[model samples]
Target: MNNITKEITPLTQNDCFTIFSRVKKEFNFPLHFHEEYELNLILNAKGAKRIVGDNVEEIEDMELVLVGPNLSHVWLTHNCKSEEIREVTIQWHKDFLDEKMLKRNQLSFIRRMFDRSTKGILFPRETAQLVYKRLLVIDQMQGFDSVLELMSILHQLSTAKSMRVLSDATFNNDQVLNYHSRRIDKAFEYMNANFHKPVALKDLAKLVNMTEVSFSRFIKRRTGTTFIDSLNEIRLGHATRMLIETTHSIAEVSFNCGFNNISNFNRFFKKKKNCTPKEFRENFSGTRVFI
Candidate 1:
């Protein structure tokens, strides 16, 4: 999918964060990413397809997620019958937390949460329901009160026990490695661009000026996965999206996602998603056009 870059500006003058609440009949946003950290809550959006980096899943009635800087994500209406979809979004700059402040004892949990969010973070439904009221009130608050409430909500989320990290390990690993080496960044860019075709370890190693043996170990150490596994994750991400958003047949989806055979695609997709392509598509109630 082609993802667009979105610019997020503060809602108020001199404010470091922005919060928005809207009720719409349809979700029309394109697949996109932004530089700011984003906290999004959706209500009455059951069966919506959520894409975060290399992760793709269908959401239930209510959903809450935190996406880190530049992580591609979007919620597309798939099987929602609700006439009204309520969404609340809060965005803040990554630099909002100063280095010294993040190291404080009291902020350790929040810091850890932020680190985990380099991939997308999905909070439990119960936790989302508990925080829903406060999120609704945030739009009505002003000045310091609004900021304080937002902080409190984040603190509560940081301490919540039931949460899952979306996106594949390789995606998060790329983010981490990019901070330490430019070579890794280039390697990731190449992989993302060419995942539909064959990728050779020898070529990647040459790009990084390492022997194939050394490159294999380097990939495993840096991404916590082998090169083949990372490639599969990227392909699966695309395949899953197509399964949910398009009317493609299983064979077509698999082929388009770079798998050479139907059987191999079925096996890998099942291993990753715990369901067959047909079953995954059947789970959706209906599809709606974006307004």
Candidate 2:
């Protein structure tokens, strides 16, 4: 991504956060990312296309999502026919809450939610409805009260049920690695670095000084996926970047990303993104405007 725009938001040093409320006919903003965590609520925008990292989906009438800092995201008008689309966006700097404060017992749920936001968290419609009232008037509050209100909103969202993560976990490069096991961490570190080449589970097991069957069980228990699937996820992450950043052919990108052939690449890409590589690239075309 060279084409993905980097948005320099209006949030200043003196502000805890910035809120933008607007009613528009359609979405026209380009795909972009910024150095601020964002909570966006959209109403009456059914059929609109939402792209968060490598995840693309059609939105419902009411939508709420929390996107982490520097994650590429955008909403396109697409098939939406609504003449009035209501949107409320709240953005805060990453450091707005101290790391120490986030670790406190009272803030445990919020802290976990923040960590999951790196992949973009999609709040359910029920939660969205419950909190939309507060979000609408939060900008009207003053000083410390406003800060407290924002924190309250986040805490509520953190405990909501059925919150889905929109993007692939590996799509964000800044995600922290904390499998909480030394062997698991080492295995993943090796997998990430060597994703462009052919990988074998036997080799990884040996590298981690464990037998193949034992290593497989350990990795699955810790990471919740098989070794081959994890390797493919890493390869797909790099492939998505190449698809967005380069003009290379699909077969070339597949090979360069360590997939043996185009069909396998297409299968994995569609399995993860619900679209072929070509379509994924085209989604980023035409309407992207940078300034």
Candidate 3:
């Protein structure tokens, strides 16, 4: 696998498409938004507020949320601190399912659910568990079976009793579109371009036309994370993508993610994922080293 870069971009693009999704995480990062529809189901985890689109609430176990294309959302996994590991995630392209079939008599309810997701949608615990069981099978299957399984999951979500649309922000929420609300799009763009290197707070502050102190407060409020937190999030994100999509040694993946040495990388990886890089790769491929 190619070395991953640590630089955080205003927007992360994978071959022209914005990357969206997470598999399992020991803990998630602060608030970040991207250009993709997002559906998340986290089981047996507790956390503080997750600002899905514009709606905010305290998060609890068996939580489920669906956000539309370009909508802003955050899941606060930091609040939960336990030795036990328990989490799951399932996200896909907005058009993963056929569009015309969305409204083809049988799926109108599901289509309506998609429309409602433009704001954001949440499922009650009972409803989430029912769909969660189906979703586990969906993630494990491939080809036509996967498609059918996903449809089944959607159908279940659409009919949940305590279902709710979360965000009240417009489809054109500036906050979602490059932090336009804070007028920091340029700063964000530059950050992504040069995150791999040391970026002084003063330099980033100037880029956004603010003093360091003001910029610090502004960013933390905007994204619910400090600057360093955001930077590490980018590094880990790149590492995770490479782990899932490519074949590379753990040492190589660590360097690609901007770790200066193996020891630090191992610690960070284990902290964030509750597993080492080698274990991550092994779990995904179902392969183990006998040695």
Candidate 4:
């Protein structure tokens, strides 16, 4: 798997957010996370793999996504053969919209949108196309006009009807709770450490000092997913990273991700990702290895 690392993206002194529009021949960034919120737009890069926290998928000709602070993400030039790849990236501090600012009635939707973005959010094609056009001209504005345009862009995104949340439940557990529940925190800590093994629901229930039924209901209420589904999501998260970063065979990857049988692994992967493991791996170009 690629060595997931933290990156520090530099920002300018006077700007609340920094924006960049670049035309590059290749996407060579490693799998990394940063402290700032990011809105990225990519054009003319089809069949590229987009890795956001525990989620992995292929992008089409144009893609737009909002990634929250410290969420690992990267776009690799998988099958794209474009001579010039157009990309626009906007980065802002996590506190750019403070709690007080978000509490305002007018910003309620944007606040909720930002919260959901703790697990990366992908805008649909129509919204993407609309924002893509706006982004193309944003660099031309200056001072207050620039800030206004950016706010307009965010408002448009906040109202979009069909955005997809990319990462799985495990990836958002910590962010969603914000250390509010110690028991849930401990449960996640244990799960992260032992997900590669056959973790029993009874064992987990006991660890949290509850019966199996009560524990199941508690977890479902907290995470909006069943215990088994959450465990599989954690395993699949690791499996996807392995598939992208390692040369291991599907069987080996499955076993390493705690699946004892290949058939069961294949079934679970297809159900979650809508594609077979082999096809997912093949979506990326053979030449690009981001480690």
Candidate 5:
């Protein structure tokens, strides 16, 4: 959790990685990552973005980006002129294919594709358009033919020249794997429990009995973000859920999420999400609830 892989295992042992996803709304999720190789083709999107390991950017359609396992990222909508609809996102596990294909065979070029993933991958416009078209065709196929088409896609991805990695730090080491994880875990637990409502930095620092500055640095070193940022993440996380699944008004959501006024909530949401509250809600529903 906290965007890191605890262990490195053989590729063949891992499965259950989803190969594709489709969404019909503007996405409202936080910066979280899983232990899989994700190849996403965003057919439609308009938002602000945060790619934790390397960048914080603005993302729009049609985007083709590849996210490596455990790389923390988020693309929040600050404002949507209309509804947000995403077409296809293809995410494959690092071990989804064969071991020999990745470890020993240059015939597959899978390892090279993974190397490119270190920086995150973004396919150029025309290429993504082509990939999406082919993916649509493959979606209608079944059985072995489906697998063959997917493998063909991966093979093309392996040889693709229109790719770029999205982050700076390739290694996302799990805190649980660290010697100091117990302390880190306790601190994180406490932060999660009380991030909303008024959170005092000094009090949070004292929970682990450290000075504010020292604690802040300690947290940043462990999670690639400061303790305050972690707290805000909690609040923002809740806000995202409400925006997507509930019918709360923006001011109400703001107050419930621990922010004071409409302006502050707007500012914070925009900074973190890259889109206004109304836009986020519209991405999911036309329900006119508060953002």
Candidate 6:
């Protein structure tokens, strides 16, 4: 990650949300994060690279994603050559939805969806097609009615099927680590705390009171990734932050993140970020967008 910018969104403290719609020739925003939650819709941008946390993918012609507060993301022009691109962005404060309101029976589904958005959520094509028109018109309406309409859109999206989580579960430190199991929580807590040191599956299994083999299976089932992969993700997350906030040498960053060797660290970092650590730092040092 380059010195990823932190965007101060236009939503005032008193506003429920803000929407921006545009027809543009290209995507130019820098990789950035914000304190507000964002729902962004883009059309005619196939081949554009979408980066959300540690996940990066070439977007389709039509795409929609919900990015949680402070999660790094950006859409780059890449191979997208479309002269007419349509984009709609909606941003809201973190406290826009009351905690108690989200817990209600009518809003439980939205609550769970919001929780998953911490990693960024990619709506399927069908859902994106269904919601894009609504998003486009949302800014035109005013007052309390517009807020209700936005809620309606979220409700529809919440119930939509097959929305995929786009980033690693442990990529964001502030993300709630809830696996609904005490053992899983404990294991992750330990991993996050000691990710900068040598850690092994056997040690983690013992800490969670399980045999090595059983612990491996349990973690795989709970997080959909093996123990080693999960640990690597944690290390990579910290490494990204360090890259942005520190002037340490690339070798230092690699070693301090617990990678035993520079080669292995470079391999993993490139695989996750699509660029070398040095390239990432240089990119961030050049230009940035405050939007």
lDDT, residue 124, candidate 6: 98
Candidate 4 lDDT at 129 equals 80
State the local distance difference test value for candidate 1.
Answer: 0.75
Instruction: Report lDDT per candidate.
Output: 0.75, 0.82, 0.62, 0.78, 0.62, 0.81
lDDT of 5 by residue, 22-128 (tens): 45545556555655676666655666453646676776667777766666655666554436566454555555664566777654476777766756777777667
Report the error of model 5 at residue 226, Å.
26
Which regions of candidate 6 fall more than 4 Å away from where they truly are?
A: 173-291
Worst 10 residues of 3 by lDDT: 1-10
TM-scores, each model vs. reference: 0.58, 0.60, 0.54, 0.58, 0.52, 0.60
Instruction: Report the Cα lDDT for residue 73, model 5.
Output: 58
Error of 6 at 149 (Å): 0.3
Residue-wise lDDT of candidate 1 within 1-291, one digit each (tens)? 233433323221134676667787777666766557899999998888898888999889899999987777888888777788888888876767766899999988899999889799999999998999998777677677777887889899999997999988524323333333576667766776776687888888999999999888877777666888767776776676677668889998888878888999898877666567788777634332111
Off by over 4 Å in 2: 173-291
**lDDT score at residue 188, model 4, on the 0-100 scale:** 69
Which lDDT value does model 3 have at 76? Answer: 67
Our model 4 lands, by Cα RMSD against the true structure, at 12.4
Candidate 4 lDDT, tens digit per residue, 1-291?
236644434342234877767787688767877667899999989888899989989889988999988788899988889888888888877767788999999998899889889899999999998788888777777777878888889989999999989988424323233324677767766776786798999988999999999999888877666888767776776787678769999999999988889999899887666567898787644321111
**Model 2 clash pairs?**
none
Instruction: Give model 2's TM-score versus the native structure.
Output: 0.60
Superposed on all Cα atoms, model 2 deviates from the true structure by an RMSD in Å of: 11.8
